[model samples]
Target: MTGTDQQPVSASLRIDGKDAELEQRLDDELTAFNAAATGAGAPEPLSVRVTDAEGALVGGLTAWVWGSCCAVDMLWVRADQRHAGWGGKLLRAAEEEGARRGCTEVIVSSFTFQAPDFYRGQGYRETGRTEGIPGGHEDVHFHKVLAG
Candidate 1:
């Protein structure tokens, strides 16, 4: 093989404590590479937050928008505020924002012990599940088509 085809060998490896700078640099590099490879552009963050009259956080949803998809990373509501329907409102707002940003679908996952049925109530269909999480539970994935 030609010299140009030879892969460089790593001489050492070091495991270190958390470094924010290194984490940011790695994220930036990988994001650029993914954008270039998939033509999806860099993932943009989308969030929906709920607060009380005193501005105390009640619940929130966080997600990343890439190409035509919005992936919900977290959805949480204060225990006291949960059954009052804030979760649905937050999710609907996120979906609307995603549709406004040109996304056609949204995806989210929940642990079996968490809110798997909640997503279903919001019209998200179960797409898959990963078994054998602690305590014999599963990670359930869901998908929903945004209404334009």
Candidate 2:
């Protein structure tokens, strides 16, 4: 080749129309994968049962079983029904259910504004604590071993 002559040069740039579609499909797949992973690892939602003493559903409790333990998610009695042992009754019911489900222990969590001492009075021991959540609030965790 002469100094003034030029050799052939080859170059290519591919733009597939399906590339965007493929990217979108991959994104959808990743999203589905992430959701499935999270759902499979997350604990089940608490199951709740309510009771109406008269015309009002004043007493209720929520719980969930995890492995050999049950979590008492919530226990509430009406304001007017306090000090009537309804709370203990509800807790006992939840414990019975937990035992029936092969749970050997029960755990309950309550905020500083709720029934921390009440649980202690019912044979629950404070196992954990977290302070300064959100609006300057503290949470207390409690646990109790079930009777085999």
Candidate 3:
């Protein structure tokens, strides 16, 4: 495998496809990093879902609590549900839970067309930016220091 100067791509991305073995291996590696940083075992996932009056799914927040930080992986509300305070409510819930778990900061990223401004409004300060990414938009990273 090392001597070949030219060879077909042996690895497949398998987008939207499940590779349980690979997934578990990656998780194990990441968890090791988490343990080293926090001595708190693996990163624990935190999620909150929103539903309509009929209990239909509408939106949710997904985060990983690791070390002293909560990494927000996804925050989404339905298009029709926008601008109704739901986004803020969900964000607060996630942040509160993180705080309760002794998390001292939150990290999240958003595309330019996404919630960069909203994250700023929620007290998240820009840590870095990647320009011209994923086409025309910039990707922004934010970090918030939680109040003790």
Winner by TM-score: 1
Lowest lDDT 10-residue stretch of candidate 2:
39-48
lDDT of 3: 0.91
lDDT of 2 by residue, 71-144 (tens): 88778888988888889988888888878877899998999888899999999999999998777878999999
Q: Point out where model 2 deviates above 4 Å.
A: 1-50, 53-55, 134-136
Against the true structure, what is each candidate's TM-score? 0.90, 0.65, 0.83
Best candidate per lDDT, number? 1
Q: Write the per-residue lDDT of candidate 1 for residues 6-68, one digit (tens) a residue.
A: 787978877899989989999999999999999999999999999999999999999999999
Task: Please list the residue runs of candidate 3 whose C-alpha ends up more than 4 Å from where it truly belongs after superposition.
Answer: 1-18
Q: Ten consecutive residues with minimal summed lDDT in candidate 3?
A: 7-16
Could you report the Cα RMSD, in angstroms, for every candidate shown?
1.9, 14.0, 5.0
In model 1, where is the ten-residue run with the lowest total lDDT? 6-15
Supply the TM-score for candidate 3. Answer: 0.83
| Backbone atom clashes (below 3 Å) for every candidate | 0, 0, 0
Clashing pairs in 3: none
